[model samples]
Target: MHAKFEIFAAVAPGLELALRDEALERGFRKAKAAPGGVRFRGTWADVWRANLELRGASKVLARIGQFRVTHLAQLDKLARDFDWTRVMRPDVPVRVEVTCKRSKIYHEGAAAERIERALAEELGAPIDPDAQVVVKARIEDDTCTLSVDTSGELLHKRGHKVAVGKAPMRENMAALFLRQCGFDGQEPVLDPMCGSGTFVIEAAEMAMGLQAGRSRGFAFEQLATFDSNAFDALKSPAEPADLAWNFYGSDRNAGAIEMSAANADRASVGAVTHFRHCGTSEAERPQGPSGLVIVNPPYGGRIGDKKALYALYDALGRTLKQRFKGWRVGIITNEASLAKATGLRFKPTSAPVAHGGIKVTLYQTDAIT
Candidate 1:
């Protein structure tokens, strides 16, 4: 309710720092990067704002309460006694997910059952397996920490992207990758092999000062502490900022081009985003100042044969080298040799980031001469 609580913004393992920077820039108090997320302290209003505005977070969790319990009876009693009414509405349906790590109460199912029973009997809340409002319980080292998933759906599902090509990049990851490439939304961004226009649309939205969660709903709205009027105030319409640059995306597949355009339109960034059907070798620099060129090309792990991809990478490299003067490049792939095939002078690869199932890295280059 009125009291401040610890908020955790979950992100991909390699992108915690970028999310932390975003949280701090958004004025979250004491935002710090942990292993897989960024943690900060804020009130319920801040929780609403976080679910509404953060671009890099996969989910925003509000840590409601925590206590030490070594046995199932203790867990049941404590869960029943905890002030669930302070946070959860008795009429709302809720689901519980529990994970036990090196704890005396190690049965996750049993632990979840106990908590669900407590909520049903004591709090008078219905337990639905498919409920959007989740109560995540993590029991580790004899301590149980209960947190509510304030962001119902993953933040990456911004609700606009309906069509996608194979091995599409997620929006949250794309936003963080843009940030890692030093994009502050001032200059143009071009994704030469843009699968679904994720990077391009995200850039356009950021340039126009669009909130990432504008088109979506959140689980926090169902909480008892949620103030509809206050949350509506936080949803104040974002005035589009005038921009001097446009975002561009191109792909060899015509379907990909169509998908990108439709997604851009759905995101309300069609005015500033351009999608065209073209192979990587045919990708040209847009008619503007030199800016960032980021691509998520096919690798052996996800798509295409490794042997044939060499020529594709080489052609991509030659095209950029000959045509994109003064523009920086970022290539994300699971293979170092494929990135090397580009023949660009890369600075260094970033930490391995989990994409789908493969571990991919972002290989960056300085501005081409």
Candidate 2:
């Protein structure tokens, strides 16, 4: 492999700008926003650091190579010439996935099969249908781009917090939303409808400068070019910064509260996080600096009747406006009407975000007066 290559850090569709900003801030000088992801140029260590540190990216893919191919014969020839030994191991099993768009090689299965045969015949690598290491081939505009999935599992897994609620906010989404709210980990955060405590736990982890992948393994560890010692250095845990109980979450369901608390405990953020059983109406500001209040409430269509949720949104808006003065708020929900029901004047909204299978938007308010 070349000493440097293009790295694509995939994120939630609506969060492309956020991830790009995050990468730039983290010193990825070449980071730029692209469709569905942020792209940067860096060495192998950069890939490892991205997987370890980026909280907003879903996965980090290293672009191995790309070429223009108009026919299956050209693809097969290029695949055979591609240097698979640079990234893939002959012993480690890998899966190949191909996507073709606006290209002459329109058959995805045929493209994948050609690449698989090349890897097996040239590199002597075993192909597994269910392997963690994935080689992705994308044929777009007659250009074939081959990349490796360095992040085995979705970043949100985090390997801690196995407990989840019906509509739990993903940790990656929570981190980006927190960034959108201008959270710097110096203030307290509250989630009145906290599901599985994603926001609170992520906030605590951020405050302590904890590496997001510290508790998990990565697919890069199984690759041929992987440096265990150098990667281990990256995994060296940072000292947890001294912090108080500034992160808090609450839910009306006892089961959800239990899950939140357990998740927090498993994440090792319990010391700085507190989970309680309370509805939005009962949520109160903690006795300290006011911070962000972010929530991903049920979309009503899935959890309850749309008509019934208006009252819930109204009560939530009223509670925050009445009590959470000087604090900012971010609401992620599908319906603009539902967000408007809050009666909280939000700043200009952004494009809708795809959460689960539904489209949601982040409604932010200037510091509540």
Candidate 3:
């Protein structure tokens, strides 16, 4: 475990730039956007901080070591020769995942088996398929790059949200979508179709200066190199700002409203988050200045008939345009016609992002006059 190593923050494929921006804003060194993630150079402390603070990352991986290997035997011998004790404890269990592309070792199962054998037989580490700690080995073009997953569960878990509505938006994706909508946490945010309150809660947390991982634990805590005291020091107490505006969420389903309120309470943002049971047509602007109105309404791919959703989008657009003057809007959907149905003058849409196996795009509008 060197003082510094290459760290990668994995995000959804279309959100690499947003993650890169977040990384750079957090002062990560040499944060560069790639196809699926952002790469940076930092120490173990940086890795811990990234897992704690980055809201857009799905996982943080520490690139521990790499080597050029042509065959399975070479990988096995090298895995055995590597100093596992430097980063992992023998008592803790770990699972090895292997992916091969244009490499001599094409069999992923065999490669994983060899790595597992090396850890079990050579290093005396227990191998479990369900272990929280993961060792990712990517054999690409005959080069083996070894990395460890520092965030145990997906970062989207957030650990506090236990209840969810049908086809709920993931917390990580919600946060990035907020960023894409130019939300800076200084203004009010209302999600008209706030299922499970992800967008509202995330906006409230950001406004309060709360860390995304405040209520969660990380897999790095189980690693041999993790320093408890140092990590503890990194968790500076959150001194929430005195916010002037509040976050709002409205849903037609009473169950959704209940779930949103409960999740907001669990996340410690209940004071600033307000959830109400109301339909999109009934949504009205808050008392304060107009801010961002972001919504993840149901589309044809996720729920209901495509024909029925057009009226829903039409109603939502009519409500926003009529009631929320000077407020910007963001709508996420898979269908272009659905977005067009809103009748809001939207700027060009963002790149397509994979959500629940369907590609969705964020259609945003300038402030309504």
Would you estimate the TM-scores of all the predictions? 0.98, 0.97, 0.98
For candidate 2, list the clashing residue pairs, or say none.
none
User: What alpha-carbon RMSD in Å does predicted model 3 have with respect to the real structure?
Assistant: 0.9
Candidate RMSDs in Å, in order, are 1.0, 1.3, 0.9
Candidate 1 ranges with C-alpha deviation above 4 Å: none
Model 2: lowest-lDDT 10 consecutive positions = 236-245
lDDT of 1 by residue, 1-369 (tens): 678889999998999998999999889969999989999999999999998889999999999999999999999999989999989999999999999999999999999999999999999999999999999999999999999999999999998889988989999999999999999988899999999899999989888888899999999989999889888898858665667889999999999999999999999888889998989888988997999999999999688898989999999999999999999998899999999999999996768899898999999998999
Query: For residues 245-335, what per-residue lDDT tens digits would candidate 2 score against the true structure?
Result: 4798988999989998898888888778888898899998889877899988887666768888999999999999999999999999999
Off by over 4 Å in 2: none
Q: Model 3 over residues 1-369: C-alpha lDDT tens digits? A: 448899999998899999999889989978999989999999999999999999999999999999999998899899999998889989999999999999989999999999999999987889999999999999999999999999999999998999999999999999999999999898999999999999999999988889999889999999999999999998858665678999999999999999999999999899899999999999979998889999998899688799998999999999999999999999999999999999999998768999999999999999998
Candidate models: Cα lDDT each: 0.92, 0.90, 0.93
Compute the lDDT for candidate 1: 0.92
Ranking by TM-score: 3, 1, 2
Shift of residue 238 alpha carbon in model 2, Å: 4.1
Residue-pair clashes per candidate, as listed? 0, 0, 0
List clashing residue pairs in candidate 3. Answer: none
